[model samples]
Target chain A: MDSAAADRPPLLEVEHVSFRYGPLPVLTDVSLAIREGDFLAIIGPNGSGKTTLLKIILGLLKPESGRILFQGRDIASGGVRPKIGYIPQKATHFDPLFPASVREVVSMAFQASKRGLSRRQGEEAAIRRALEVVGMAEAMDRRIGRLSGGQQQRVFIARAIVDKPRALFLDEPTTGVDAGTQDLFYELLDRLNKREGLTIALITHDIGIVDRHITQVACLNQRLVYHGSHAEFCRSDTLKEMLAGGHHLVSHVH
Target chain B: MGAFLTYSFLQRALGAGLFISLACAVLGVFLILRKDAMIGDGLAHITFAGVALGLFLRMMPLAVALVFSIAASLGIMKLKERAGLYGDTAIAIVSSSGLALGLILATLSRNPGVALLNYLFGEILAIDTVEVVLSVALAAAVVAVIAVNYRKLMFMTFDRESAQVAGVRVRRLDALITVLTSVTIVLGMKVVGILLVSALIVIPAAAGLLRASSFKKAILLACGVATASVAAGLAAAFALDLPASGTIVLVNLILFGVLAARRTPRA
Candidate 1:
């Protein structure tokens, strides 16, 4: 709201956002901000409107009230609608009958991202590099349906970041994922966060693996129930309440 | 066989068949993948009303059918949005109404039975030079739109909600596909009759998906299978004194049976 706040803008800002489906109120005055290079985890129950908020921030859903600012510019009418990489909550349900190659799926980033995939290097080079990042270079030409669920998920992640997006949003990425592969996924996300400085906003009902990785946590239940730093979150009474509600970090199963 | 080829009627029939096959096969793969195959069926029913209206008014049937089918397709989309109806529900409502209206109109017209039978069963041999030209032009337009927007359309097909979030202009692409499919149905009605036109749009693509290892292969296989089936079906129609539309659909069913029996690539 002031000039001083404009100097160092957060990567994304959800300012007093609210939404509803028909007459039913889904989200009410929810707000949060993600600074550059921050890995923020949004934890909520099934009906707590986590995915709805993510959709609004991703510009897929229009909020009934309030504004979303990406890099301090209004997302609704902003000139620069930042290139955001998204892994949908239901990414796993992709019909197996659809015969698309792993390479072909990732190549979507070429058309999707406004960041302009590759001007200097050839398109194949970009595809290869992205595959390599996800440890899927060997499976580039393989039919997507032939890969395991975890492997397909990695391919989707590769697709998301192939164009070098500024922010990555993962909506309940761990559901149905095996524990071992889930650890690997978190490690990959951690590497992307710490090494590449890629900002991430992960939405999940489960918050076990991400607890150690996230810098901030926003727990939602149809409203802004908790919004604070991870350290403060660990010590606050809200964390106890969350734990009482069975929202505690689920330990990785060996 | 040679006599059939030399006849101008047969030549026009074959030309229209091939062009419609190309359009249907290409568009069908996307429609089937998007779970919109029933759209073909729905549009075909809508075209029936268009045809009856045209016959009653003494106007060009195909042109009227094209306009009506396109309008009906858009209407289904609008109803789905405004009424919170599911896609299949919207299609069912519009298509059943269109079919009923066509039946009522046909009953009200002079020589109603003969007019209805001609359009329902199709008379490809009676398709004039002008009809052939119109069929080719409409088919070409559908193919061109798909070719230009292949990638974007593919994105929408597999995951429309995600595509919308990713800024793929989902509604525009939805409208484009609906229009293309309606036009394809109009052209295909001449090839296989209104009753079996959807068979042309769904079966070839269904067979293609049974064996394709990738998106490109599915498309190529569908188009190849469709055009070849049309050729062979036309030949059989002449040899057996059967309707080309029925023969073509029979050929497609056989192809689908063979392909479905094959193993699919799995994880």
Candidate 2:
């Protein structure tokens, strides 16, 4: 997998990205590459800048010094933004009283992806296909806040994927989900990665997700601790000691 | 009913009220959903400062109010974006200072007490042709901006970060909404008064979102509720010989109460 990934130019590259809040540094010269069709899990301990790094890559924040390149083009120059979908960390933390149907929320991604005087051409079909992929077709007309936590996350995933993004980034998608639902969520992500060949980068504290679903692993601690195949990550004695030491990694059981 | 149609002042008040209601209700839905509802209230306070400053200078109060509130609204947005202050905290800081400034200005401009009271509580029946024309123009602008940016605004209101990732130009839209809201609040001052103007913005939207199944329905229902309440409140105020702003706000509160009662069982 490493050789294969190396053979193809990386789909997304984060080079020497550093960020700070006020005077205190949050990320210190961190860099990693995400290849096409690679299901990479970014794991780190609390305050490890895992989320901040993802925000920079997604263009939510400006890096102090580094740059992000998508398909070998600097995204800052800004022609067509790399078709990427994001489910933010506070995705499910939206106001419960917000009145929006599942279909409307999904369709918003389609409308929002386009500029000015949006024509609703193919919008319904796109929303339906996205919902069907997320196994949420049955709840298309239901209010999003009426759904359970895991189901809401699935709807958000549908929203992210409705525009048919080349790569998907999710920040802590299953933070409040139940144990049983977490398994199903991971299964859905696995299907997206394997069956649909969608590239996925996820920020998680769950070490278990790396073993179960991720093909590639990028461990971060305000820096790129490791970025390689899941097998290499598991076998590396140095990383295992670092994980056991609880300095750079925090693993959640369920 | 014939008198309502015949009185020129009543016609002007109704004309301005309906437009103001439509603008407020539509803008209110986005503000309510974004949890930035207090912004209308905040801008209303700033409008008070504007009015007081204008009166002290012996100038057109509404124009001064519009400019002052717009600048203050942008300041609030900057504080939230750059200073990392929470929305309510920023609103509170700006709004309290506005109220204080208005009080000082009112004191300095002494004996404009009757004119100040007219603005504080609203004298809708006394609305003139110019105020009515200004209301129509500003309300039209508000509707146009919202209609043009409807999709982006909905996406942003639902989830700001995801909308940003989708390249929605969220900050620009945020500024647009804030400026539009400031304009709406300033226009509302004549119909509902500076003190109760936000009620016209919030109560109807709250009622609409309480029962709406879709975003479109929420907006439509809010507009419906706002317009209906203004019409009813005007007639009731004329009959009861009460203050127009208070009556209009009461009518909105009643409608919201009814909707809440109907919704509580289902929730």
Alpha-carbon shift of residue B154 in model 2 (angstroms): 2.1
lDDT of 1 by residue, A117-182 (tens): 233357788888888988999998888878889998899988888878898999989889888999
Candidate 2 residues A1-254, lDDT tens each?
A: 46887775689999999999999898999888899899998987788899999888988889999999999999889575878999998899998888998888988886554644456788888888999999999998888888889889999999998888999999988888788998899899899998998999999887674467888888887888888988788777646677677654435322
- The runs of at least 3 residues in candidate 2 whose Cα sits more than 4 Å from the true structure, single-residue gaps closed, are A22-25, A115-119, A246-254, B81-87, B264-267
Residue A174 accuracy (lDDT) in model 1: 82
Which tens-of-lDDT digit does each residue in B124-226 have in candidate 1? 7788899899889889888887877777777778767667766788889889999999999988888888999999999999888878877878888889889
Per-model interface RMSD values are: 3.7, 2.2
For candidate 2 chain A, the 10 contiguous residues with the lowest summed lDDT are A245-254
Docking outcome class, model 2: medium
Steric clashes per prediction: 0, 0
> What is the per-residue lDDT of model 2 for residues B29-69, given as tens digits with 9 covering 90 to 100?
99998888999888899999999999999999998999999
TM-score of candidate 1 relative to the true fold? 0.92
